[model samples]
Target: MTATIDTMISRLAAWLSRHSIDVLRVSLGLVFVAFGTLKFFPGVSPAEALSVATLEKLSLGLLSGYAAQAVIAAMEVFIGLTLVTGKLLKTGLVVMTGALAGFFAPYALFFTDLFPGAPTLEAQYIFKDIVLAAAAMVIAARALGARLVPVREPLERVHELRERAAA
Candidate 1:
């Protein structure tokens, strides 16, 4: 059982190294672009309410309605474009991280509404951004030639990577 699990893990890692970055890049790019595009048409995106409300609250009610939604949509599109083309990757990752951070805000700020005993599907949806963030972080770190790892010695290696990048 242990050997089988190890074999599977090794194969998965090999597959990821061989092609997963491109796949993740394209898939995430498409997701961002498609979802953002949908925001242009009213009544399409389900998260419109949650998103706008979160933004309004974060912005102290300064941002609300379609105008605020449009900005968010534009940011998603920009992140998608950069990721899809593999250009301005650092910028794209930064924007993506920021966007996901916003998506994560509901769990923190609206704990009661999002989690009255059990979290709503909406909260689950927002929580999935953590996985996306992890994927993006992997790709971003790769783009920077920085190897953060679950497999390798992170403490020693990450320090080495930072020192190398800094030099």
Candidate 2:
């Protein structure tokens, strides 16, 4: 059992490294974009979701509520853009690490009381940020730069290649 677990872990790690930064970029970018959009829902502003008042009470008043909300929004948009363009990807991942950590900190530390009724919404709103934060950390460690190689290929070429190979 132990040997099998080790082998599985090794294989997973190898696969993770082989696929590289685009995986991390796409995952983190989509998550931030989705969460950021959700923040605009009724009573669900970034400041509210982040428990900004709690942070202020904790003497993290240096992060102004409005500024914090703006930063969160900006980070989400910026990370999404970077991932799409494959530009300055490493720095974007590093910034994403900070943004995701900020998104998760409130639930992880202060708001255990607020999590029972809507399990899936709660999980996505809270735990997903934590998981994505870890992913950002992993992506940061990989240190992906502005990707020079084109990431996506048009679908037409794939079909053409298959036809030629079959012939």
Candidate 3:
């Protein structure tokens, strides 16, 4: 029974190892697209006010209000399309890095607003970006040719299995 369970677990892990990164990339892309689309409409995205404020501050008063929101929305949508389509992914990841930095800028720019004795709703929202950043890192690594090798088996054994499966 133990051997059977281990075999099943290994197979499951192998399947996940094969498909998880692509799933993550697509899911992240969808999230970006959804949020970006929301920003296209004024007063629709919950992050709109804070996002505008952050951009205005970061751009040293050069960007603000609906214009700022539109810029961010366009950037996010572009990143989403590249990630989803796997075309110009390196360019998308580059833009995503900048956007992620902007996303986290509020912690420094509006420390008090985001955290006035216990975390506010905006703080909670920004905190979730850490996960998105990490997911993006994984996708970027994969784009750079990294693979998720299962750990239960030896590297050689895993390669052998993959080779046999390919045959």
Candidate 4:
């Protein structure tokens, strides 16, 4: 029974090691596309008002209202496309880094509004970006030739796998 359980766990881990990063990347892309699509239509996205305001402030009033929203929407869609298609992924990661900075800016700029006493819904919404950022980091590392090796795997075996993957 113990051996069976161990075998199951190892199989599950191996499967996750193979597919988790791709799944995360694709799902993240889909999320960006969905959210960006929402901004295209007014009164559809809950984050619409805050997103516009944040962009306006970030852009020093250069972008506002629908224009600001449009810029954000376009950026997100572009990121989504690159990630989903695995085309221009490095560029997408670069853009993602910048977008993440913008996404987190509100926490520093509007601390009081986001957290007057208890956390507001807006604060909660922004907090979820932390997970997205971490996932992006993982994807970026993988893109840069990093691989996940099981702990029990031998170092020589891992090197062989890396060599095979590179070739």
Candidate 5:
């Protein structure tokens, strides 16, 4: 029974990796869509005020207010659609990564506000993007079949040279 259960668990893991990855992708896309849609109307998203403030501060006043917020919302919606539809998933990952970089700034820029006592709701919310970013990385890796290797790993060229020398 134990052996049978172990086999089933292994199969389930494989099934999730092979057939259910898209589920994760779509769910993340839905999250982006919901957040972006919320931004379309004022005071709908809890993160709106913080987002606007962060954007203004990051852009040094060049971008702010409803206009800047609208632009961000549109971007999130576009990326979300791309992921949801599985069209240009790679490009969507790139865009998502870039957007998350901006999003992550608040964790540092507003550290005091975010962590005055405990992390405020806004801070906690913004911080969740890190996990989302990590999820995106995994999705992108699976989508691309990326293999992670150490930086000091020997290059293919070196291996080829060694083979030639042996010959």
Candidate 6:
């Protein structure tokens, strides 16, 4: 079972390297752009978001809330553009990972009350972000030139192919 799992992992890693980076860039860019735009929308007030009162309860000032939220929105927009243009992908992915960590830290460790009645929703949302963060991290690591394990082929078949090509 362990061997089979290792083989599968190796194959998956090879597959990721073979695929084009543009696909990942587009998917991540669209997500960040939409989310950031929503933050700027009139009805999407941070003070009224599900986590707002909890933030105040923790004694965070109004200005702090506004500033932090605004910074997050702006970063998202900037990262989205970076990803879509395939420029500075490593930096964008690193920023996205850091952003995810920053978001999860407070909510996961200190603000249980903010989600007192919506455990399922809270868990689902956090989990989704975790997945996104992992994806970004993976791409960042790969783009940094980490080598994937080679795929295996039958040895006899390899020799046969070489003989045919030599003819």
Give the candidate number with the greatest TM-score: 3
Q: Return the candidate ranking by TM-score, descending.
A: 3, 4, 5, 1, 6, 2
Candidate 6 local distance difference test against the native: 0.64
Clashing pairs in 5: none
lDDT of 1 by residue, 1-167 (tens): 64466567666776767677777887888888988887777678888888888888888988899877887899898888888888998899989888988988988788898888888888887888887888888788778886433363334565577679999
What CA RMSD would you report for each candidate? 9.8, 12.1, 6.5, 7.7, 9.8, 8.3
After superposition, the stretches of candidate 6 with alpha carbons farther than 4 Å from their true spots are 1-16, 45-66, 114-120, 147-167
Candidate 3: list runs displaced more than 4 Å.
Answer: 152-167
Clashes of 5: 0
Q: For residues 1-167, what per-residue lDDT tens digits would candidate 2 score against the true structure?
A: 64465566566666655676657667667766776655444466644545454445444577657555555567677887766566887677667666665666666555655466654454455665566666666666556443323333344565577679999
Residue 138 displacement (Å), model 4 = 0.6
If both were scored by lDDT, which would come out higher, candidate 3 or candidate 5?
3
Lowest summed lDDT across 10 adjacent residues in model 3 is found at 153-162
Give stretches of model 4 more than 4 Å off.
153-167
Clashing pairs in 1: none
State which candidate, 1 or 5, has the greater TM-score. Answer: 5
- Model 5 TM-score is 0.79
Error of 6 at 139 (Å): 0.9
Please give, for residues 1-167, the per-residue lDDT of candidate 6 as tens digits.
Answer: 64566567667767765764557767888888877766665458432253333334344455345554566667787778777777887788778876676556557554554467766554455557776776676667667886444667655666688679999
Work out the TM-score per prediction: 0.75, 0.53, 0.87, 0.86, 0.79, 0.64
lDDT per model vs. reference: 0.81, 0.61, 0.94, 0.89, 0.81, 0.64
Q: Per-residue lDDT tens digits of candidate 3, residues 49-167?
A: 99999999999999899999999999999999988989999999999999999999999999999999999999999999999999999999999999998878755675687679999
Tell me the deviation in Å of residue 165 in model 3: 32
Clashes of 3: 0
lDDT of 5 by residue, 12-120 (tens): 7667756566787899999888898888888888889888888888889999899878977987998899889999888888888878987888887889988999889
Residue 118 error, candidate 1, Å: 1.9
Q: Rank the candidates by lDDT, best first.
A: 3, 4, 5, 1, 6, 2
